[model samples]
Target: MFRIPASNNGLYLGSVPQSAAAKNGGTLITLDHDMATLPAVGRTLTVAELAEHVDDMAGRLWAAGIRPSERVAVHMSPGFDIYVLATAVARIGAVPVMLSPALEGESVAALLERLDRPHLLTDGAKLDGPLADFPVADLTDRTVVATGSRPGAVSLDDLAGAPRQQPVLLHPDEPALMTHTSGTTGLPKLVVHSARTLRGRFRPQERLASLVRKRETVAIHVSYVHSRMYLALAVLLPRAMPLVIMNDSEPAGVAELFAETRPGFIETHPNSFMEWEELVDHPRRPLANVRYFSTTFDAIHPSTMDRLLRASERRAPLFFQIYGQSECGPLVGRGYTRKNAHKADGRCLGFAMPGVTNFRLVSRNGARPSRDTPGYIEVSTAGRALTYFGEGERFDQQVHGGWWRGGDVGYRSGYGCLHLLDREVDVIPTIHSTLEVEDTVLGRLEELTELVVVAGPDQEPVPVVCTRNDRPLEAERWRAAVADLTPMAEPVQMPLTELPRTATMKIKRIELSQRLRTQEGRAS
Candidate 1:
């Protein structure tokens, strides 16, 4: 019953080939922006073919000099290449620092510098562009590798010439993976995870697996660089469930793909779900076959939930909204149906995931013994990350005793369900709860897609809204929406796509506010 899985090598990689061998391989789609490319369209592989590919990549990565505790920065878009290459690095016990393409070049260079400019692996586009941001003097000290040609970098294809080698195993506490947090409030910091912390997620993934019937098709369009994504793939791909992995969440593209696959379970970021809500009007009704909808990373608006459930044809389709952070895998989970979606309070995030997490509230006055009094959220979770890479002192600051500070302000309802108000840094000095006010406005208007409250010039609550169909904001509707609450600044309209976002789709309030202030200065 005991499994001695290779460290840093996601366990599923070792087991998937064996489990899938001698059987029809489940589908693995690598949906990317370049739909015309070979890696984009769905690639169907037999278990043997999948096994062969993993082995080949693993061997190549070992040949590339990726060794135990080595850091390899991955600077590619999410797709088959990224997944395979990152896994290959893990196979050799080198930690893959998962970086997002959406990250700005300046931030990327700064983060690389902070990480001590570890071995950089990127593509032709990044080598000549993003990578150019680093100081010229620094390039001489680091080994650069990329798929296409670069003056000083080694060609990735050269790895094929080097002999293949078996994976290097390490202790459970050794570093295995590294990814940056969303950085909604400040510069993103790298978070490191070891087999010890990562193994805790295995049980929850297994529990999630039992909920889905064996062999049911799964369609996933979420971030690959996210901390839990590798673990998720480790569990799902090996289960032999046919999969559709998408990077581009464009409504028509995803709808067309789902029409052909007819996936039973659909999992994506909450924002993607909202983006896909337009599929409700699609002639094919893409979500009709979906039985379960899983959303993680942040709280979702009730309207977004309502639109999606009504579109699904299932009689009792369940929507799982997960509330937690990358530092901690998942602290709480709550499910809502069409009937209960509208009934949900704006803040009722969820109850703790059983046997996996322990949570408490530390108020300004200290620990709160009762419910409904909002306070700083804290948790002791089996799945918490080991530390912030290069910032062990910062990691120590967030922990008190054995509990990890969640950096959120929320309270437990009388029924024990959690209600998150605002992130500690996002809090406004409004007479009312800033997030509660945003939720109230959301409930009042059906056409409003998203509303975020940020501090304005006078330090008052200023609401930024993304309206459906890009409709003009009506002052009357806005006035009525917040009529009973504290007087607030007039709403500022913003296009949803223009909003600065973390990889998970959570808005960057501080960034957007600063941008707006700069624009105002120019106009005045």
Candidate 2:
């Protein structure tokens, strides 16, 4: 369904930059922060330069003994280098397992064990900080440090003059990359992806990218470990779009970068966009040149969408909200303009991509699914991950007849708009959709930077709030805002930093709920 030439062949992460460089060596890529691996290379580079760095890193890995088809887990210090390193691992024909830097040391060690002692690529910061208490030596086959040296670890710097090896291309169906789930329940699961499967995830996004008639700089601030980041590069690089990779999400830093870069296309996690709401009024008009604002992680608040859309001076600026999961790529989405964003229903996520994707709501009870009684939201797409590495049975439970049922409960509107209500695990007896309540209250109270509703110790719907700048939340204002909505527990105001978050900035609802329960237990 996509006209992009790169889509014809499988979207192989290993060869993406090389192919792009071959097509257009001059395509500019600007980064907000310096790369960890290439510390002296500076922040800006051409497509050719990036490909060269990837090739050099691949040679380094080859010297380090990472061979074709072997698994290499990448859990290193934060930077844009993670993607480059993962790509380097892929170039050598080994699957790059992406473990988010935000993952706890325990979780990382556990995931390393799950990979059956895969080679680990990390940095000394992690070795000395979060991982200081864990016996990392017992969890992996070999430890390769990308930066700094640790005893019993191979350093990439030591192999600077290693001979370059030809890029290895595995079978389209062979595992090429692995990323973990958000781990809201427990340790994250390793999601396995192949060249062909990654291509599946690329097509819909390719079609979306095709919508941009003119070449404008595309700025992206997504988790370095996410499949979306790779797919986004697959779409942008081959097309030779000028790219800006953002490492900072702070409002002031983002303002300076966006103002200086003047990116026309911007994409980030929904929560990041919410955090950027303050940028709307920046004197420099940081978002003025933006024509498209896109987010794929979760349903964003209408207010946040409206503010960003209005900030753009471009004619017909659009905010695209794509509802998707880690396992299945972009499933359904619709764009909103300033004219309609304020009135848009937070629950009514858009329609599925025609031909490329399809969704079905399986009944929770004997009756058919509807607004009141949401059902299991399952999707059938080529973009679905192959399987959970080393957890085949757990993966099997979610698949039925080629349909992947992510643990989400939602219904479809009469007009076929998918309405996401709540995750099955986060559902409370007192509320139909915790997310809907959050969206409503957040839109009503401008002071709120974030809001989440989780099941309290008594199964009561508790609303957890984080105000802008961590200011005290006015009791009367909050009461007035939720007056017309469902009854909720007393608001628990906390610093935004205290809320548990995934790499992509998604709130760990289950973790937050567990903390609430623990606090209640202590009080009693």
Clashes of 2: 0
CA RMSD of each candidate after superposition: 3.3, 3.0
Model 2 Cα shift for residue 168 (angstroms): 0.9
- Candidate 2 all-Cα RMSD: 3.0
What is candidate 1's lDDT per residue for 4-117, written digit by digit as tens?
A: 455443343333453555454644543434421124224554445556666676666666565667788887655655666676677667778888877877777777787786
Model 1 scores a C-alpha lDDT of 0.74
Per-residue CA lDDT of candidate 2, range 1-524, in tens?
Answer: 11223333466798999999999999999999998778887999999998999999999999999998999999987888998999999998899999999998888888888888899999988889988998888888899999777899999999998999998878777788999998888899999998888999998999899999999999999999999999999889989899999888999999999999999999999889989999989999999999999999888999999999999999999988898889989999999998999999998889999999999999999779987889999999999999999999999999999899999999989899999999899999878789899888888899999999999988999999999899999999999999988899899999998999999999999899999999989998
- Per-residue lDDT, model 2, residue 332, is 96
Q: For model 2, give the 10-residue run with minimal summed lDDT.
A: 1-10
**What TM-score does prediction 2 earn?**
0.97
Best by TM-score: 2
